[model samples]
Target: MKQRAQGSAGAGTPPGDARVPAQPRPADAPDGFRERDTAVPAARAARGEHTHSERPIPEPRPAVQRSSVRGQILDALRTALVTGELKPGEVYSGPVLGDRFGVSATPVREAMQQLALEGAVEVVPNRGFRVVERGARELAELAEVRALIEVPVMLRLARTVPGERWTELRPLAEETVRAAGTGCPATYAESDRAFHRALLALSGNEQLVGIAADLHRRSQWPPVRRGRAYLVADAAEHMALLDALISGDVDGVRGLVSQHFAGAG
Candidate 1:
């Protein structure tokens, strides 16, 4: 995994700190999530790495590693799509996103193809890809499907999975809360996806888990724009849902799951 800043500022630091170096993407990180730059050029300057007559070391720009460039670009696009940066029905060229991440168009095209398969974007011949618009009806349908698939599965897990097994998943829930607290759209979106994915994985049904994860990703398109209070409440609901499951309250879990979908719709 690569270390990077987890804020919503994207690759760059907050404005008014132009000299701050851009954090470099790590070679092995799958998710191209950006983080605050830990590089300290000032310390180097104090060590005489630069003087008044010489210029400071240039900040490294955000980029994808060649070994996993396509995957990272896909991750970046997912974040952008989730945060509504990639607006629905808006066509975007590979060169444009490539330039944004300081990478080449090949990986961007590859990534866009994957997003196309996910139904998040449609490829435009002789041009680029356009983000698919998700209407209210589409969202409602998605929520319905999720409720249909997940509710029973969760209820059964609550009955079958031991309390200790569920307890071990507390950390994932806690991480989701921490990400929600940060209000970083990408981080929170991914963490929220992760928490649910892990919970469903307890069913030991890979096919079901994959389907649920896909639905989860689609649900995140045009991600929640609500502020911290909403996210905090959302996180709390996740914990509450977990508690219901851990306590083997099948009825409570079913109701909570239904309520969650209702709220999502």
Candidate 2:
């Protein structure tokens, strides 16, 4: 006839033929070739029960987010200390601050521990943490120590760092002036330290920059009870010092540095 539909018997059954039954795959089949358990969902559906795939996925836990929240709390606490919102010597409980910040007490407690390490606050046993009450004498002493460390290094840098380099730092000095205008002691203190730190960095001494920064931070804790006028004046002094350094006026730099620290005390 027509060659008996050529090789049909050798190919077993043709596509969609009902004569052949399916065979199970070999156990050594690769994982990618394995079949999924499609019957489970079908069996559950036949029993009028929900399928496993229909179950909701769980939301991830928030443990990873705690560190970032703790850091924000620490910064806020430091700002409160600098702005006098957290009065010196006053004890503040973690739960109270947590309620105010819209978070749990754990992050607040962790932040307070960091502040304690920075000497901005002290632990008060079961009470919580107390803002460290730095007095005039201690503030003066901190300022004096800062002056001793920064002044000589600045003088040396003034003699060597190029005019263009000092000019480039003008923006930082201007930032201090802008910060002072905010009337927030914390803002001004941060900008003030930034300018000083940048100037000290030109000395190429990482250790000196670190030590001076530490002293500067301690001095700003419960920042001096000076008026906005004092802040503006201090900011202007930064610009004046920059001017002296740019013009290579060693004596002028020395005088400005001395006067700056003197008022700080």
Candidate 3:
């Protein structure tokens, strides 16, 4: 009998036989045991081709949805608070607010928690949240604190921040005037804060801006019973301050800012 050639299947099998079984590819492998295609990736890398995996990355949809819902709820609650719909010193349950806002209790509770942090509400155990009752004394104290912080900063900036920077703030000042003319306290309050924030931002001190903004919001929370004339006057003060700053009139800026906070108190 003829001796089989090396590596032959058997004596009867021819060289390079058609019936020989081939190695399994990655696609043909069973679940949990699929082989990785190392060669194709290497080839692709050498060719400068992208070899990213085809699987899609999962997103945290539920958490994102909940966050958006919570933000909307918080904004609605703030609007209600500003409009005096959520009366000061009144305790309201999360579910009750949720019904009013057409949402579930969870988002409302989350929003109330934020409001508590902002000093707009106080959490009551086993109950819900109480809208914080801010009296005139508190408003006056907030104004005093704000003046102590912002007046010196504005004066210093008025000397150094340059005419162009002060000019840049004119639009924000004008926006406050427009908001004030709307006769809506909430609108004017927000615009008033924006104008101050823009001015403080020129000082390039983020901490100061944040602190002033918080104090300003706290002061504005007590609903203003004053008429539109008060809002208009307040808006005019912003423009006057801008003019003083642009003209390099430190004394004028000082007087305007002091009077502004005095009126606020």
Candidate 4:
């Protein structure tokens, strides 16, 4: 009976001698909840601020970094031509390009030769290479190749793609439309590339993918000059293609896809 009374008294009291005690609490309060977020910005400014004399970005890289500056020279010159900063039918010599890229003539020579091999420029004996001018002929040929390679693959996708696969592409389509509306050319260009790439990805054939990427790169010359793009048609065509895909309209997908390429001219 005495033991029973002792047990009841122990249960009624807290484990510690004191009946009242502090409750356990979380280790730390959430960041920025109670304290001002002053430490971050002030610490960052002390370490380094975006003030002048922070050192200019150094000149855009000179040649000889990798691919031995020579390859760099070639890529730079190609960029100039493709972007229309360089005019067609204009000849450039090894010496001139070397000066432009701040490299020696040897690298410039190397680059020009490579460009000539790729048919990106014309190299003549005893004279320098001319940037090859793009024409409708190339565009039409590219379109023809795309039609041969991609249309059938898309038809296969139209038939083979499950509804779940089709639904996954909705976000890419919306991103394309949003990018186009923003008037950001580069953003739109990427979103534009993404839509076609998503469709071609469905083909699951590596060789077809390589061919499609090459054609798309070559086709950029025409639209880039026009300041608009294959993007508008691409977005519209992708939308139509999606509809046909969901509806199981293989024939309609092929025709609409072919029409999209037809405008490549």
Q: Which 10 consecutive positions of candidate 2 have the poorest summed lDDT?
A: 14-23
lDDT of 3 at 170: 91
Model 2: per-residue lDDT, tens digit, 1-265?
4566655664675444323223355577777652334444454555566886776757556765898899999889988988899999899999999999999999999999998988999999999999999899999999899999999998999889999999999999999999999888999989999999999999889999998998898899886789889999999999999999999999999999999999987
Per-residue lDDT of candidate 4, residues 95-163 (tens digit): 877777777788888887876766667886787878777788887887799788888888878888886
Best by lDDT: 2
Using lDDT, rank the candidates from best to worst.
2, 3, 1, 4
RMSD of each: 20.5, 11.4, 9.3, 18.0
Pitting candidate 3 against candidate 4, the one with the higher TM-score is 3
C-alpha lDDT score of every prediction, in listed order = 0.82, 0.88, 0.85, 0.70
lDDT for each residue of candidate 1 in 46-142, tens digit (9 for 90 to 100)? 4556545566666554443553888888888998998888998899999998999998898999899999999999999989999998888888888
TM-score, each model? 0.73, 0.75, 0.78, 0.57
List the pairs of residues colliding in candidate 4. 64-69
By TM-score rank, best first, the candidates go 3, 2, 1, 4
Global Cα lDDT for candidate 3 = 0.85
By TM-score, how accurate is candidate 2?
0.75
